[model samples]
Target chain A: MSRLPSVRSLVAALAFGGLGFAIPAVAEEPALEIVGMGSFHVGGRLAEVSGQPPRDIVFTPGAPPARIDPNGLYAVEQMYAQWFKPRTERGRVPILLWHGGGLSGVTYETTPDGREGWVNWFLRRGWTVYNSDAVERGRSGWASPDVWPAPALHLPVGNPFERFRIGQGEGSYSHDPAKRRVLPGNQFPTEAYDQFPRQLSPRWTTTDQPTIAAYIALVDKVCPCVIVFHSQAGQFGFRVAQARPDKVMALVAVEPSSVGDPARVDVLKAVPTLMLYGDFIEQDPRWPTIRRTGIGFAERIRAAGGHADVVDLPAAGIRGNSHMIMMDRNSSEVAQVIQTWLQQKGLWR
Target chain B: MSRLPSVRSLVAALAFGGLGFAIPAVAEEPALEIVGMGSFHVGGRLAEVSGQPPRDIVFTPGAPPARIDPNGLYAVEQMYAQWFKPRTERGRVPILLWHGGGLSGVTYETTPDGREGWVNWFLRRGWTVYNSDAVERGRSGWASPDVWPAPALHLPVGNPFERFRIGQGEGSYSHDPAKRRVLPGNQFPTEAYDQFPRQLSPRWTTTDQPTIAAYIALVDKVCPCVIVFHSQAGQFGFRVAQARPDKVMALVAVEPSSVGDPARVDVLKAVPTLMLYGDFIEQDPRWPTIRRTGIGFAERIRAAGGHADVVDLPAAGIRGNSHMIMMDRNSSEVAQVIQTWLQQKGLWR
Candidate 1:
C-alpha cells in the first residue's frame, strides 16, 4: 500500500467514441504511473484568478491524504460505498445517512433530539452508518474556484448537466431558510435556490463547485459502508447511485421526496429504493404542504415502475411517526420495519 | 408557428442505437404541421402498470395549459407567466418570480397586504412579472412518470451509464421546464423554478437523465427579456448561462447564494451578472451564511476569470434589507441598482 494506486481519470477521448474526461498533468512513479490531468487550484479572492492545474493520478491505497481530483467524473468517486464511520471495528457495514432539508448529513445520524438518528437507526441493526454532507450543506467542500466546462449535449456526455459544478448548498437558497419550505416530494431540495445570490455569490455557470464525486472517493478510500438517505440527501444519493451503481448494494431511501421530473424515473428505477412515508393524508389543507408532497412522491415512485412498497405506518404495524419519523418514538419500530423490508427485499442478507 | 418544424433526426437515429425508449408519436399533417412536445397536463393521474398502448398526443393550443413538472425544478409554470399581467404599459421590465425552499413563486409575489407581490414589485416599477409553483407544488398539475430500461450496470465499456427510458414532463429542469430548477436570479422574472423535471427526479442521477438539447432549444427560443433570481433559481440560471450563454443579455441576482460548490463558475464569465445581497448586519444568521456561499460562488466565477459586480445592499445605503429584500419595500431600490448596474455594464439598453 506504499505505492500510488490506480486512479480513475475522465479520459475525454472522443473516439467518435467515449472517454469521460482528460487528465492534464501526469506524474510517474515505479509501479503505477500516476497521470495528473484536469486539475486546478481555487483562488481565495474573487478578483484573483488561478491557472488550470493538471490532475494527479496515483494508486488508490498507498497515497497519504489522498487528493482525489476535485473535478473527477462522478464515476471515479462513486466506486466506493458511502457511510458514516469510514474507519471502524471490522464488520461494521457502514451506513451513510443522507439528510433531509434544513438538516446536514451529521444531523441525519444524530439529530438535536437523541432519538434514533439515521445512522444510529441502521447502526443498531448491525450496520455501519456513514453520514455525509453534500457540498455547501455540511463540512464537505466543493470543486475548483472556477466553474468547469460541462459536457457537450452529445452521446456519452460526461456530466452533461454540469451537476458536478453545482454543489447543493446556499449561494443556492437565497430565500430565507427559516422561511423557505422544502416540497416533501421535491426532487431537488434547492435546485432553484441558487438564483437568489447574496451580495457575494458565484454564478453557477462560471463556478466549478465540487461534487459528491470527491466525497465519494474520499469515503471509499477511507471506509466500508452501506448508503442510507433520509429526505434531501436522497437526491445526492440518487446521483451517487448513477455514478457508482455497483458500490451501493441496496439503497434505503426514507421518503426521498423527489422534486425533479419523476418522468425521468430512469435513474430511480434500478436502485433498490425503500420509501417510507408517514400517514399523511393527501389534499389536506390542514397538513403541512411538504407532507402532501411526500404522499404524492410515494405514489409517483410506484408509478415509475420502481418497486415502491408504500405501507401506511399504522397498517404496516410501524409506530412513532411524523414529518421526520427518524427521531420519533417509534424509531426502533421503524428500524425493524426497515430491516424487515430490506430482508424481505433481500437487501439485508 | 403553425408549421411543423424539422429538427435534427436524432429521434430517428435513436433506433440504430437500440434505445428502449419509445419515440414520441408524431402526427404529420401537411396542412397543420404542428411539432410540439408534451407539456404538464394539469390534474392528470399517472397511469399504473406497463402496457404499450396505442398512444396519441393531443396537441391542444391551451389544452394542458402552462403548468409545471412536479419534479420541483423551476418555480414558475407556463400558467404563472401567462396569467401574470406584466405592466408592460408601465416602464418596468418583467420580473419572473421563482420560489426557493419554503416559498412557491407565489410566496415571493404574495404579501400580507397583498399589494407588493414579487411580480408586483417588478410590475409596479414598470416591469412585467411572472411566478409559479414548481411542478408537484401548488396548482400546476403535472405528474412526472419515470420510465426506463432495467439498469444492469457494466455492459459496454464505451457505452455511457445505462440509459433510462425517457420519462416525460417539461423535460429536465435544467434543460426542460420538467426536470429543471428555476434559478434564484431567474426567479425575479422570465423564469422557471429549479427542479422542473424535464423527465427524471433528483432522487435519480443527474447524469442518467436524458439530454437537454430539447429544453435548451426552448430556452434559446425564450428567456431573452430580463432575468432576476433568488436562492435555488440562481443555480438554474447558472446552468442556463452555460447551456446558452448567448441567450442571456443581462442578469440580476438578489441574495444569490452559492451554487453548493464554488468550483462551478465557468459559464457566467461572459454573461454580465449583477449580484446583489441584503445587509448581513441587520439580517438573520443565515444572512452571512448567504454571503459566505454567495462570495464563495462569486469567487469561483472570478477564479474562472469571469467578472461579476458585487453589490452589498448595506454598504450601498440600503441597510436592513433581508435576503428576500427583492420582494420587500426596498425592492425598487434593488431594481434601480440592477438597472444602473446593467446600464453601467452595458446590458440595459
Candidate 2:
C-alpha cells in the first residue's frame, strides 16, 4: 500500500485532483479507490524558547524498555489529521469525523467492539473522509504542563463504565466476575469490554478553547464539508458550524452529550444539522438535560428556517443501541441509516 | 411443530417437569421447545341486559360477500393473553409482555421492520412468555362509547413522528416523497413507515382505570412473573407491581413515556425495576420531563435499598437506538443483553 512515488512524481500526481495510485481492477477488489492519503498538523505555534538541552534516557529494557531524548520539544498540543480521498468521489462534501472525550480519531477508524467503523463505512459509499486526532489527542502532539499551561487529565479506570452506564455504580469496577454488574439492556459489546479501556486517552477540561481553535483550523483546511461529531466533540462540531456556517455543509451529531449556545442558533441556518441519539439516555441523570439543550438549539434553528433533523433510533423501531452507535454489532446498519439520510440531504449520490 | 397431545397424555407428560417435545439434535434447531401454549381472557363481566341484544347485521363487504352476526358482546374490555411455555423453563419467572399506546400484543410479535420480534427472542432464552393484548386494544376487546364513559382516541398522523422524534414537524406526513422529511439519525425503520401506520390502534385517554384494572387482573392470573412494559403500558406495569409486589418478580420498562406517582416509589422496594430508554429522548418536549420523573423514582428506589436498574443504552456505548428497542435491527442482540442481565439477577438459570 505504501509504494511511494518520488516528490516530483507526487507533485505531478496532485495535478489530477490529488490522485495517488490507480488500484488495479480485480474481481475481489472494492469498487472505490483511495486516490489521496496524506496528513498534516494544524494550529501549532513556533516554539519561542528553543535550544533546550536534551536528556538521555534508558535505551532498551531487558530490565529496561527503549527510551531516548526525554527532554526534547516533544509536546505541542497542535492537532494532527489524516485525509483519505476517493478516486470516484460522489459526495458533494467530505466528512470530517471528530471523536469524543478522552478519545482520538481512532474512534472512527475501528470501534471498541472491533467492528469496521464509520471511516470505512463513509469511504465505501464514495465519500472522502477526514479523521482527526484533535488537539492533545492520539497522533496529535501531547501537552506537557510545562508547555501547555494546564496538565492533561488522566481518565481513571472504571470511569468509562460508570459514566457510560455499562454497569451500575461501583459494581462496574468489581474485579470479581460475579460482582460485575452490566446494566440491563446495555447495547454495548460487553464481550469486548477489555478492548474499550485501551482506547481511552488523557483529556483536559481547560483545553477547550485551544482545542476548539485547532478544530476550527481543521475546518478552515477542509470546509464546505460535513462534520460528524460524537460525544465530547459534539460541542466542537456545533461551535465550528456556528463559526463557519458557509463552510460546514452539514453537521451530524451522534449522541452528542453537549453543545454550544442554544440562543445563537440562528447562526446555523445555512448548515443543516442532524442529531442522532442512542438507547438508554433517559436513564442518565446528565444526558437528558444536555439533550434538551441541543433540542432547544435545533428548534431555534428550525424557527430561523434552518433544516435540523432529530432521529431517535428507539422511537423509530431500532433499539438496544448504546452511545457508541458506530461500534455496536449493528454499527454498519446504523452507518447505512446515516448514509441514507446523507443521501436524502443531497450530500451524497 | 404442532403435535397436540390429549389431556390424559399431557397429564402423563407432566412427570418430566412439564416437558413437551424434545428439541431435535440438529444444529439448525434452537435449544428451547414450546411445551405449553394456551390463551385466556382476564377481567370481563357478563352483559346484564343481553336479552335485548340479539340483532343480526351484515358483517362482510362486497355485493356477494358472506354475512354474519354483527351485534354481539364485542364491547367487553377484558384483556386477552396467550402464553408460550418452554419444555425446560430455565427462567424462574415467566415474562408478561405488554403493548404500548395505540398498539396491541402485536407490538411484541413481528417488528415494524419485519424482523422476528421480541416474543421469539425471550422464548428462545428458555422463558415462559405471555403476550397480552391489553384492554381496549387488539383482540382483548374494543370498548364502545355506549359501554365505556368516553370514545376511543385516535392518534393523529405526525404526532408520533413529532413526539417520537422520527421527523421534522408536520412534514413527516407529507404526501410527496420528496417533501417528506425523516429525522436524520432516526432508528425508526423509516422503510417501514408504511407498515407503522398500520399498527396504530384506536386508543382512549379515559380508559386508563379500566385498562389498569384489566392489566392487574391479568397479573393476578399469572403471578410471580416478570412484566415487560413498553411506553403506555409502563404505568400499568408499575401499578400492577405495586398492587401485587410479591407476584411480580421483576419489571422491565422500555421507554415508558409516562409512569406512576414518584412519591410512592418506596412501595416498589421489593420488585426490581429496569427502565430502558432509546435515542433522541431529550429532543422530545414531553420525554425529558417524564424521564426526569422516572429517574427521580429510580433514585428513591436505590435510596430505599431497592434494585432499580436504569439501562441507558446510549451511555453504555450502544447508539442510534430507538424507543422500540425490541424491534431494532439488532433486536436479538439487545434481547441477549437483557437475557444476560436476567441471568445475572438470578431470574434465569
Q: Best candidate, TM-score-wise?
A: 2
DockQ of 2: 0.01
**Model 2 DockQ class:** incorrect
How accurate locally is residue B266 in candidate 1, as Cα lDDT from 0 to 100? 75
DockQ of each: 0.01, 0.01
Over the stretch B140-232, how does candidate 2's per-residue lDDT look in tens digits?
545433456553444433445555556663335553446667766666776765445434555666677777888888888777898889877
Q: Give native contacts recovered, as a fraction, per prediction.
A: 0.00, 0.00
lDDT of 1 at A280: 33
Q: Candidate 2 lDDT, tens digit per residue, A199-243? A: 555556667777888888888887779989987787788987888
The runs of at least 3 residues in candidate 1 whose Cα sits more than 4 Å from the true structure, single-residue gaps closed, are: A1-349, B1-80, B83-95, B142-218, B260-264, B280-287, B303-305, B346-349
